[model samples]
Target: MSAEIIETLRSGRLANLGLLSDDDIQFAEATIKKIVNNGSETIRLVFPDQHGIFRGKTLSVHHLVSVAANGIGFPSSLLLKDTSHRTVFPIWQKQKDAPDYILEGALDVIACPDFRTCVDFNWASNSTLLICDLYQRNGAKIDFSSRQILKNATTSLQLAGYKALFGLEVEFQIFRIIDDALKHDQSQMPPTAIKTENITQGWQYLTETRYGEVEEILEELRQASETMNLGLISTEIEMGPSQFEFTFGVDEALTQADKFLLFRTMVKEICRRRQMHATFMAKPIMPNSAANGWHIHQSIIDLNSGLNAFMASTDLTETSVSSNWIAGLLHCARDCCLLTTPTVNGYKRYQPNQLAPTNVNWGYDNRGVMLRALIFDGDPNCRVENRVAESAANPYFAFASQIMSGLFGLENTLVLQPATINPYDVEATLLPRTLGEAISTFHNSAINRQFFGDDFVDYLTIIKKAEWDRYNSRVSQWEQDEYFNNF
Candidate 1:
């Protein structure tokens, strides 16, 4: 407790709290060297909130060691908020069902920078962004935090002698702003949607002319992605008006989540600075706008042999690893929709024949089905693409849903159903057609309760139901057209 002990370079609150390991301290020492060597003036500490939005504070490089050792603090309620930045939980009154740590006056949570995640954002020469791990004052992980959920799933996989590889196909739209919505009335919670026009005309899916017109901005995007080391695979003009897609190369589950969130933040910032708007909403409520789908490509690796589990010589069946995984996915697809399609707007992407899924089914290399198997002979890179999610889904939860469901299948030896040739006309169970349906399905799922636990599931469904309740309370245009006129 003496000043001399406290003044020691590595001794601080986080160290006394026994959260940061010696390796973490050593890593911090190395990071300080990097800041001095690279001349970074600011250190950005960030964590992905429940909705995958980056929230954090930037510190002067002079205090990097202290911040890294003692850890930066932020209000815990950041994770309890809904997408609209509204606190949905009853934090004021302690509930018997919820833990005191979460409801204790919205206490400060500690954010310790992960040295391995330290990266110099090239464009921001003066700043370094480090993804942090959130912990309680008692140094326990926040079980419902996006990173913790994904970590638990991955740990389960590792314990079972397997690993997960994940790749992402992200689709979003870019628009020319018609109004920035700076009026006083627009400054409400979450702000009003800004008015926008398409930067390009409709219906040119990857035509060179369309790419030619927007090549400059496209290059700008490509450069920023590459600079961030996001493992860029390819960028393409999507089927929708002014919509674009970017695919990332496969990586470990956690790394891919970080890259995905970073990409989302980067795209929006870069576009807004250029007097443009970039939207990752599942289906932006705009005329002629196409729904954006986030296709998750996943495969498993055996820890013993380090071989692709999906690369089997035998045909996919109940005995095949890939089959077991896919069967798990199909079994839980309906229940997990709340996580994979986490927004009221995301459900609109499920229309028939829109290159998005409406039914819970799988097919071999099929875009029409919910799960598309790409397993082929002699292909070590085979994976199944889950097209059930929208671009706005939180990558941590989305990836965890895959790991958790796949583990359930492997453990139970679940049998894969026959692949459907006609997904639109199949007798398969339907995906939840609306967010309300998703909430109900998720709330009632025993398997979800088992995997994510009752506490996390209830926390999520409660917030989503709040959103659904708000949506239903509002009078829609269709409701006005049908009821207001008819009544």
Candidate 2:
């Protein structure tokens, strides 16, 4: 539209930076033009932070070319922040084990947009959206980025001539916003949660009336998801107040991660416009609210034959590939628990007979176990569903942990134990019951040290430990109720 912008685009600054492939440069130019012509005013350049929250800057349409040529600058410390927005790393200290990155004083980092992830947001002021990848100002890839970490984990599988497929069975809650927390005192680190009331009295799970009660809002979300190409398979009423479930069609880990984050953002945006609130918190603080779980259904495909690699082998003497995968998942369940259930509140979901697995064992079609092995003979849809992850877990990191664990099993030729009939009562190890336990297990895990480098493992443990420390410092109402009267 502008002569200056056109000249900048033709200069090939993006190509010169080695940020995009030749094909991506062409696509990026086209996408820029398309966004301008499509009447979008602004494009939000977003990158997922350490907590899986999108954090980035917005650029006017006129600056697209210039910004694309050189990435938008953001604080490198954004990636180092805990959920409370405090930079947990001791950047100010020069101790021997201090992190290698220059993170002090919230220094600058660059976010390079990925043209392939561009999506038109017809709902948000008719704007375009593109997710970015984090890079240092000097152009080095940021190792702590959740997306990059996941990509690194998948490289081993990709080189081994296999591709992973992941399906989503995530649950969340929606409430009508009674208070938006706009008052000055409400604003704080992490902010006070808005006051909300449930849209439906949701005791009858999957009943027709339960769905019909909130069908209008649900349809709006479904249609918005379709527009963004998020692959929404179905929506169902979950078994708690204002709780719901969304199942997505299977796709590769990267695509699924992008789709899920976008979907979560879309739901919040849409609900906000309608004076409602949507939360993916593992367990929202409400009376009798059921916790949400993110059940990841994973399977591998043979790159040569394009067949499901998890299918049970017909041979009697040889253990099935599915069994080995199960064994690996169980072995690493404790180590990876921090990734799958990151929040202090998330571990509350691990209870027996709640359709959330409490123990590290596999079972056939049983929802009570951590890994549910579903291998129908001759059925190509066979896969294992890991029920250990909470809905609030970062999708990229969660999937990466799974892929890494399964690869460990396949590489080591580990043998699977017999499937469990009594998932809770069995002698198998129980999942970490608290955030503190999860962090300790993850920090001491050899598998984590091997799969994710020591730097990353330490980085993650430090941030999570910060969160746990904050939790421990606060005295809850339960503590007051139990101690004050007795003391």
Candidate 3:
């Protein structure tokens, strides 16, 4: 009966749609055998949603044999949630010519498992986790899937005979939990913020003394990452209080995106167990708080020649490909700001002389520039670092924005503006100073529609618009302090 069920799933819509390849089938069988032999009682079937948050069902070990091939069915409404976890789309009040699956009465969207992404759940005893990509019931790919967006972007790059690799520098803060904030009044659609105090009074960057203070927690996090194979290269103390940064090894864009999401989830789980809170929020609203940034180190390879495409042939400093890629990033920086930053709080981190870029520009090994070129004489590691993204940005979307924008430059053979010695003072376009400005810029861009399909552009726009509206409608603490006393 078990064998029959497994075969039945392997022969289902996935096979018909040509998604269940021979390799995929073999991988699933291997996973089942490993799970059964290891006595794993539960399996976490998960996929990153629109915001790249891990969400899925946990199933029994007995069902793994079948589910390994069949996958989990998640409500389509899961894809429509904003950052608040509130379903932003009007599913019940569906409009004419709306999306066919998501927001259409919350129909089932299949979470197709990629067995290659299986990892041992070290935090949970005898549990395993597998990541997935979303698909419609008819086996068509979900246009709005965060994973699929990166997949599509990568696929496009491949079609042009180039492949992209990315490395991630992730920064976040960990604090001692003062209050769980679970009282009646604190409960809402989005729960109230929990109170936390800095564990380290950190103004010292990468000081050994400071590292010794939190070595235990950092080691615990490091071990968890190692067990899950998250490609963690190093963990170091960042410039601010209780702020830490984890840098990972380079890999293909899509694989890195998966690891990035899992790493974020793992950090939170490990921290919360110790009565601590971990936040990737770009700028935490606290005294003397330093902002977190996600600096993406990216490079492309020419598949035909099997060489680094950005390598300068004779030009001592930079190549045409790298220049065009930089220009593409700068050109689309305004339009794709919503994808990179994605939050009202994110914009607050872009300040002059703060190890963050405030304007659209690139410079050679310059920390302040938006794009920092790291090219050396005939080194295989010639790459560009994009520093504009917040640590909280969705990895898939941010990487997609880079790939799509870089491709735009390569295809058009655009030239970059001269590398700025003084990035902040250079004649360059400033990044959107507010989320509202970003939304308007993205909404007006024809390029956004050209890259992400019309469906996704519209879907994301509505979701972001809802978030912006929520942020604007609220009478903030500033409003109360500034006007209440005077008025």
User: lDDT values of the candidates?
Assistant: 0.87, 0.85, 0.87
- Writing each residue's lDDT as its tens digit, candidate 3 over 1-487 gives 4466458657866776777886677667767777677778888889988776899888888877666556678998888888898988889876443475677788898888788898888565788998988888878888779989999999999998899999989999999999999999999978999999999999999999999999999999999899999999999999999999999999999899999999999999889999999999999998999999999999999998898987854242344788888889989999999999999999999999898999998888999999998877788899999999998888999999999999998899877788888878846789999998998888778999898877888888888888899999999999999999998
- Model 2 weakest 10-residue run by lDDT: 312-321
Q: Compared with the true structure, what per-residue lDDT tens digits does model 2 show for residues 439-476?
A: 99999998998888887888888889999999999999
Candidate 2 residue-wise lDDT at 49: 82
Deviating ranges (above 4 Å) for candidate 3? 1-9, 96-98, 314-319
Write down the worst ten-residue block by lDDT for model 3: 310-319
Candidate 1: clashing pairs of residues: none
Q: What TM-score goes with each of the models?
A: 0.96, 0.96, 0.96
lDDT tens readout by residue for model 1, 1-487: 2233234435787888887677777666766777668988888889999888899998888777778768889998897888878988888888665566887788899997887887766574578889998999888888988889999999999999899999999999999999999999999987998999998885989888998878888899999999889999998999889999999999999999999999998899889889999999999888988899999999999999999988864377547889999999999999898889999999988988888999999999999899999989889898999999999999999999999899998999999899888989757799998999999999999999999988888888877887888888888899888898688
lDDT score, candidate 2: 0.85
Q: In model 2, how many backbone clashes occur?
A: 0
